[model samples]
Target: MMGRLTIRDRSLLRDGVKAIVSGDVEHLKQIVLTMGVHSGRIDHARLYGDIDDFLAKYAKLDLGSMDLGQIIEELVGLAREHRISVPKGISMLSRGVLTLEGVLAVVSPKINLLEILANRMSAEIRKDFDWIEEQKGRFRNLYESSQKGIRIPAQMSDLLRMALKGQAKVNLEVIGSEQPLASLDRMVNRLVKCILCAAMLLGSCLLCTTGMQPKLLGIPLVGMLGFIAALLMGIWVLWDMHKHK
Candidate 1:
C-alpha cells in the first residue's frame, strides 16, 4: 500500500514543480536526485545514474519549444522504471492539499504554453546582438581615433573618464540620435491640421446660413470666401497624407 507523502516529500515535489515551471533543468535534476536517494531503496542507485544521463541529454536540447507535460511524463516514467509506485489520480489527503499531480493539472491546461518561452528566448537573443553591435561601434571609434595619432573625441574621452571614476550619469543623450517624441509630434501636427480644417468647414456652413453679409450672386461674399478656404485646406490635408504615405 502507498503511504501518504511526508512534509519533506511535499516540499521536494513543490521544488520540482517550481523548477520545471521556470525551465530550470539543472535545479530539477538536483531535486530528482535528492528524491531518489531519500527513497532508501536498493534499486534507486540506478535512478541516480538515469538522472545524470537525462541532464546530459537535455543540456544540449532546445528547451524553448519543449512542452512541460513531456518533461513531467519523463519524470513519472523514470519513477516507474525504478520500481517506484506513483498513485495515479489518487489523492492521499483529507484536506485536498496540492501534490505534484495537482500542480501539473493546473499548469498543463495551456496548449501553447511554450510559445511565451520561445518569445522570451528570441528577445534575449536580440538584446545580445544589440549589445555586441554597440561594443563593436565603441571599439571601431577608438581604433579609428588611435590610427590618426590624435586624442579621442571630447565626448568619448569624457565618457571614459566618467566611467573610470564610477560617476557616469545614466541619462546621457547622443547629439545626432533621433528624438523619442518625434512620432508623437507628427501625430499632434496631423491632429491640429484636422481640427483646423473641421473648424473652417463648420464656420463656412454657418456663414452660408447668415443673412448679414455682403451679397455675391444671392449668397454672402464672406461665406463664399470661407467655403473656398475650407476646400483648399481640405485638399492640402489630403495631399499631405498622400505625400507622407
Candidate 2:
C-alpha cells in the first residue's frame, strides 16, 4: 500500500532538491526562510539594477545573476524619494553593494581574495593574542618588582585587582597592617603619645616650678635629676611601644 506524505516531509524533500540544484548557500537561505519570508527581508535594489546607464560600468564582473548596480541606483532613488533621511540609507546600501562585489571577485582572475582576507584576519587575531601575552608579561614583571621590595604604585594594585582573579585579594589579606591598623600598631602609637604627653607636662611643670624657685633652678643636680627622670621614662615607654609594635 502507498502512503501519503505529511506537509513537513514534502517541505524537506523540496529543500533537498533545491540544495542539489543550487548549492550550499541557496539551500541554507531557503531553509532559513522556510517558516516565512520576513517583511522587507531582501533588499530588491541590491538584487536588481535600478538604472540603465550605470549597468555598463561593471560589465566584466560577471554579475549576470545579480543586479547590484541597479540596486544601488534604486537605493539612490530611495534617498531622493525620502530626502536627507533617505540619503543615509542610500550610503549604507551603496557600501553593501561594494561588499557584495568584493565577495564576488574572490574566485576570479586566478586569485582567492576571500582566503587572502581570511589569512589577513587570522594574522590580526594572532597579533592580538601576542599583544595580550606581552601585557601579561609586563604585569608579571611588575608583580615581581613589587615582591622584591620595590614600592608598588597605587595603580599597580588596581591593575592586579582588575586583571588577576584572586592574586590581589590574597595579597591584601596576607600583607600585615595594610589598611585597618593592627592592634599592636595602635597600642604602640598610644604608648608613644602617652609618653610624649607626660614629658611635655612634666617639662612645663619644672619650668613653672623653677620660675618660682629661681634659686633652686641654678642647681645642676636638680635640673640633671629632672632631665634624667624624663629621659628614663621616655626610653621605657619607647621600649614598651617597640615591643608591642
Candidate 3:
C-alpha cells in the first residue's frame, strides 16, 4: 500500500477515490488498467497486481475513526508528487491552496533561481535589441547630415521628379482599383492580428499567475503553450508586414 506509484497509477487511485466519494458510478466503471500482469479475466489480473494490495489496505481502514481530511491531504500530496491533475474541490479540501511559487519553494529553491535567471536574460536581450535600433538610427542621422546641400542638375532633377510622380501614380493604382478598399483591408487585417496577439500574450501571463497543474519546467503547461503560440503568431505577423512593406 505504501510504495512508489507511477503517475498513471496515482491518477487512477486519486480519481477512483474522488468518484467513490462523489457517487460517480459511471466514472468508476470507466476506469481501466492497461499495465500489470495479464490474466484470463481483467478483474483477476487487477487483483493480482500491486493495486490489489493498495485496495486491500484501504479496505481494512476504519473509516469511522480515520480523519478524512488527512486522507485527502495525503492524496493531494501524491497527486502533486506525480504531477497529476487534481480537481478544484479536492485542492480546496486542504487549509490553503499553494501557488506555483510556494510549490517551488517546497520542491527546490534552485527552480526559483532559474526563474530569476530567465527574467534577467530576457531583459538583457531586450536591451541589446534596443541598442541595435539606437545605433541604426544614429548612423541614419549621420548619413542624412552628410548628404545636405548636395545639388542635382536641373535636367536630371526634372527627369527624376517625373519618374517619381509616374511611379507614385502606378503604386496608387495598384493599392486601389477604384477605392481605397485594398489599403483599408490590409490595415484591418493587421489590426485584428495585433489584437489577437496582444490577447494571447495577456492570457499567457494570466495563466502563469494561475499556477495550474501539469507544469513544464516548473511553469504551468498552459502558460508555456500559450506563450509559444503567441510568439510564433507574432513572428508570423511581423514577417508578413515586413514582406508587404
Q: How accurate is candidate 2 locally (lDDT)?
A: 0.50
Best by lDDT: 1
Q: What does each candidate score in C-alpha RMSD?
A: 22.7, 30.4, 33.5
Ranking by TM-score: 1, 3, 2
On residues 126-243, what C-alpha lDDT tens digit does candidate 2 reach at each position?
7767776889999999889877765557667887777777554334433333335767677767767677757755775566545334344464455555666767777777787688
For each candidate, what is the lDDT?
Answer: 0.63, 0.50, 0.58
**Candidate 1 residues 1-245, lDDT tens each?**
34577677666765775565555666775666555533434333455667656555555655454554555567767766766554442123312323433464578844344455446655765776877788999999999978775644777889899999999978885542344476668778888888888887788778878895687877788878877887888898788778876
TM-score per candidate, in order?
Answer: 0.29, 0.18, 0.28
> How many residue pairs collide in each prediction?
0, 3, 0
Local error of candidate 2 at residue 211 (angstroms):
4.1
